[model samples]
Target: MVTVNIGTLHNVLDHVYGAFMHRTKISPLFFSGGWGGSKLELLERMIKQLFPEVVGQNCPPTLVKPVWNTVWETKTACLREGVFRTPCDEQLLSALPPECHNARVAFLTPKFVPPQRMACVVHLAGTGDHTFERRLRLGGPLLKENIATMVLESPFYGQRRPMMQFGSKLLCVSDLLLLGRATIEEARGLLHWLDSEEGFGKTGVCGLSMGGVHAAMVGSLHPTPVATLPFLSPHSAVVAFCEGILQHATAWEALREDLAAQKAAMTLEEVRERMRNVLSLTDVTRFPIPKNPDAVIFVAATDDGYIPKHSVMELQKAWPGSEVRWVTGGHVSSFLLHNGEFRRAIVDGLNRLEWKESPS
Candidate 1:
């Protein structure tokens, strides 16, 4: 069984985030997920396994332990008020190993909830009993496929608190919003981080479903990501939740209810308009096109009843000559159906980044 120490993971990530900030001159990698499947968890495990010793290096005394000293979730920094403060690396560096303090950090903003808790539970459960099955299914073979890592947890089964929260923050400013301003602001903040001297260098984005939309938006805005891979997802593709294609309640409907209850300053229509304006990444698609003119790879499910393939095609056409990969499956099935193969592609793409090759 692969033994993971949560405390270790926490400290290492802080330093790694600092290291990536130092090396890439770009923001930490942004990831989103399609519905279903533990994409975030799977990606973290894969990265750890692929680069076991790549944990942060040259740690300071203060980073040797795990501490929640940051104001991320405190009452002072509530998501409602738009105060998303995280603990800086320097603040947490004294609690980590001396040899592994400054490591590359992959800043992940999961779409749904912070899947950290659930992912840990799943990992722990697999460790005790179904160790072998876990490895074959989600850990070993599954991680070998799939290229791009996504962020959001699947809201198909139920609405995720974080996405709802993200939606709420934006709805206050305008009604009938598509993507929230907070989400966009956070995304842009990451972009600015990337453009800095120490963020990820030449980063890329890949997402599924709504996550796909996020990838499109970020890629459209940032020139760093040389490659983009969005699979079977789009922004306006709301068939499943809207028309009951999947017999599910759309996030839009839920947002309306929440808005009604809150009675905030912004009307639903105004909020929607603001969201549209901010998230209109499609409009600025031409801005971030690679200078080399290489087409990005956009994957879709031809049989995606939830998020129709036509939407994917529209993005392809709109991009004026980009790569598209159409698979045979529905929205969720597109990924779950080909878990192993999908994971392989994700790894290969990330491996393309030229990291300072460490001693094997």
Candidate 2:
């Protein structure tokens, strides 16, 4: 008889989940359409030309306006959502709907605190409709600790979601890339705003799933000292879309049918390679490590079908000295399996930060 350790079993199950559950469904349009063909090539070329080296380059500044009419007070804190216009020109905005042009947003500050010398965490919500209940549950612990938590509505999500659009619908591959750029820009603005505030102390960024990926991107680009914690996010967008469970929700089957009608012959592997450069724009490894590696903590799922273990490992390796906490079970289940542990990690990470006053 052979005895397999729990860790080994978990690893085996993770591979099983990856192999059986999240198999890729290739779409030829992913390599031929506007997002894939010359348009994508142009975008990649622009990135290379404009940002020969992404490191040390400053993110474009943005202005955020609070929706005064949308202000509300909670028992523990005040909730106010805002919207910020993306700086991208009309050409880029054409890819996204008008509603997304003005990104919806929000931030929470402790009710009674003066907000002076207090830590702030910018919490990015995962994909899908942004429910109020979900935000409260995720940010509850941080708010209790008197750490102001800011929430940025991801593009095509929440109030920015196009009218009558279903929660799981993603119109095209380009839409995802546009959303990625928008989220990163808005988050950068929010962080800058927090840093500029007189009462702001230490600032950190965090998110779950897609939000986690956005958090990592903002953490990498922002030069300011801050902590980053990405929960259950894949390190590579290319891998996540091409090989993860969420691939099904992306309408790949429809795209595949369309390609079949056009008699296009392309495999999943070929599609993945074609989208590599465009997707690399959001790759965690391509960005710089946070100012403090110790301040960066990753919470990953051992048996996550949506985010494979290799993706998390890639991010961990890229950010040397960063911490990673692995919880058992698949992506969605792991959140429930390790809720307490995840909360503690977040609280501990925020607490570990040495708060300091902003410069005059």
Candidate 3:
């Protein structure tokens, strides 16, 4: 068997093409990366390969808006629209922020639309790389020389700068109180925006690492996304994260140790009672796991210390009857190993006619 590539050959493309053509409703694919460092380039590369016109249509910084905004808009358009712009406008391009220059977007024309019906797939990148501007400029071969120059260096002047901190307060508010509720709200806003703007009714979500957890939570909460692929995440898994695997890691190791010590002092019941309000992201089994119109899970189990099989299985049980696609490596490693297959499953699942037959 050709284990290297899960969805290979022209046949895969043909299947995808068929899926899009059959349906009247448009379902563009969305890719979410976990913790900012997710392998987004790989996903983009595959998309470009499948859609040759994508790169050919790549617009230079002009036609879009401020270059940075252009990149952001373009990327959004690519995910929601299904077309990229080439021969971009100069004035419009110069106005765009640097971060927006390289982001991509696409649209579905009569020519580009496929035969089989498709569902929207949104890939969410996780919480690393704290700087969105930096993430924007990091891609493409040209950035090799100017990577460091693009950094938005900080100079704290005790007081606040209203515009500079535009989203800062909202973020803090969401983090401090919402307990993942804000993320769910944001995801809903995004889905509705896409539906209204792009004419796509149904949406599906896929995320890795942090993005995975975000996707899973939103998938479980919303009905708009009939299908969801939480590539490597479980929201409530943090209890396990803090108690078990976090010991050896550097970033969250201290917090984990503190939790362990605290747990030793308190009764398990007391601990659960106190933390239950905050750590509800994981216990999908406890809460009702909303079945995606069709829900599918992909986990990288081999060397994945961060996300254990037990966690995945536990989440799986919560989402009983859902389909789980297990791979051989660690967290995102399996994505690299079986990216093609994963991609196919996504496209195939989205293209599928009946929701009853989803992944399970």
Best candidate, TM-score-wise?
2
Model 1 regions more than 4 Å off? 1-180, 191-201, 235-295, 344-360
Give one digit per residue, the lDDT tens place, for model 3 in 120-150: 5555544332333322322222112111111
Q: Residue 289 in model 1: shift from native, Å?
A: 4.5
Q: Any idea how many clashes model 3 has?
A: 61
Q: Compared with the true structure, what per-residue lDDT tens digits does model 1 show for residues 1-360? A: 999764345334434543443235342111111111232233223223212143233121121111212213332121111122222243222321232222111221212332211110001110012112322233333221221121222211112223323321211212111122123223434344433422333344555555455556545544344445455665442332232142221234344444455566556565445334433422323333432223356766655545655566666776765666666555545556655444443444444444322312
Model 3 residue 287 lDDT?
43
Worst ten-residue run, lDDT, model 2? 25-34
TM-score of each: 0.43, 0.81, 0.49
Error of 2 at 302 (Å): 1.6
lDDT of 2 at 64: 53
Error of 1 at 303 (Å): 1.3
Q: What is residue 299's positional error in candidate 2, in angstroms?
A: 0.6
Local distance difference test, per candidate? 0.35, 0.68, 0.39
Candidate 2 per-residue lDDT, tens place, 75-124, comes to 76787766567655566676567878886666667776755557778888
lDDT of 3 at 277: 44
Q: lDDT score, residue 173, model 3?
A: 14
